[model samples]
Target: MDIATGAGLLAGLTVVVTIILMGGDLKAFYDTHALIVIGGGCLASTLIRFPFVAIVHGLPLGLKFAFTMRSTTSRDLVDELARLAEVARKQGPVGLEKVDTDDAFLAKGIRYVADGYDMDFIRDNLERDRDNFLMHLDEGQKIYRAIGDCAPAFGMIGTLIGMVQMFSNMSDPSKLGPFMAVALLATLYGALVANLFCLPIADKLHVKLADEETNRTLIIDGILMIRDSKSPTLVREMLLAYLPEKHRHEEGEPVPA
Candidate 1:
C-alpha cells in the first residue's frame, strides 16, 4: 500500500472536517447549493474534458488513490524481472510464455521472444509500444489537470452568485455574512479538489509511468541477454544495471539470496 498517498489524503480531510466543526454551525456549511455549485460544476467540467467511460473508470481509481494506495514499488518490479530472467535462463525464452499471457504488458515482449522474433524487431516493437503507452498516460493526466483548472474558476463563479443574492436583501444584514461565507466556501472547495485530488492523481500517474518504464526496460534487457545465452551472472549484472545506482552490487556480494 502507498502510505504517503493514504496519509496525505486522510490528513487533508481531517483538517477540513476539524475546521468545519470549529465553525460552530456544521449544518450551515453543508449547503445543498454549495454542493450543486462545487460538485456539479467540477463533474460537468470533467465530463466535458474527458470521455464518459474514462470518467467512470477513473472515478473508482481516483477514490482508491485518494483514500488508499495504488502504486507499484521499484523493488517489487526488479524482483519480478529478476525471477523472470532466472526462468528464461533455465528453460529458454519459450518458458516465459506461461507467465506472459497473464500480464498484458509483459506478455507482449515474452510472446515476441517465444515466437523466435529477431532481437531488433522485439526491441523496436516494445519500445514503440512503451512510448505509445506513456503518451496515452500523459494525455490522461492532461485531462485531469484541465478539470482541476476548471473546478476552481467555476467555484469562484458560484461564490459571486451567492454574494449577489445575499446583497439583494439589504434589510437582512445578517445574510451578508452567510453570503460571504458561501462565496469563500466555494473557492475553498474548488481549490481543495484541484490541489488535493486532481493534481495529486496526475502526479501519481506520472510516478507510476516512470516505475513501469523502468520495469519494462529491465525486461527488455533481460530478454535480450537471455536470447543470446549470456552467463547467468552476467545477465543478472546487466539487468541490475538498469536499476537505481544504490541497488547494484559487486559480483560476490550477498543479494538477499
Candidate 2:
C-alpha cells in the first residue's frame, strides 16, 4: 500500500468531517438536486471526452496505481542486479535460473539472460515491453486529469442553477436555507471530489509514471551489463548513476538509514 495516499486521504476526510460537525449534521449537506447536477454532470461530460472502455478499465487502473506502491525501488534494483552480477560471474547465464523476482519485467530479463539470448536481442525485446506498459500508465494519468478538470466546472454550473431557483423563490424565506445549502453543496462536493480525489491521484500517477520509466530503464541497462559479464562492482557503479546523488552510497559505505 502507498501510505502517503492512504494517510493523505484520511487526513483530508477527517478535516472535512470535523468542519461539517462543527456547524451541523451530515444531513444538512445532503441535497439530491446538487448530487445529480455535480455527479451526473461530471460523469456525462467525462463520457463525452473518453470512451466507455477507457473509462471503465482506466479508472480502476488509475486508482490501483495511486494507492499501490512500486514493488521495487532503484536502490533495491541496483542491489539485486549487483547480486545477480556475482552469480552470473561464477555460474554463467544458467545461474540466473535459480533466482526469483517479484517484478515481472525484471523476471523476463533474467529469463532471457538464463536462456542465453544475445545482448541486442534482449535489449530490443525489453525496450518494447517497457514502452508498451508505459503507454497504459500514461493513458490512466490523462483520464484522471480529465475528470478533475470536469468536476469543478460542473460544480459551478450546479451552483448557478441553485442560485436561480433560490432567487425565484424569494417569496418563501423558509426555503432559502435549504436552497442555498444545496447550491453551495454542489460547489463543495465538486471541489472535494476534484481536489481531494481526482487531481491528487492524477498527480501521483504522473509521478509514478516517471519513476516507472526510470526504474525500467535502469533494469534494462543492468541486465545488459550482466549479460556482458561485467564485474559486480562495476555493474553496481554504473547502475548507481540511475539513483540520486544522495542515494549513491560509496562501495564500502552503508546505505543511509
Model 1 lDDT per residue over 50-140, tens place: 7877666565554444444324344444455667767777888778777743346666777777788898998888888887766666666
lDDT of the structure predicted as candidate 1: 0.71
**Best-fitting candidate, measured by lDDT?**
2
TM-score computed on alpha carbons, candidate 1 = 0.76
Best by TM-score: 2
lDDT of each: 0.71, 0.91
Clashes of 2: 0
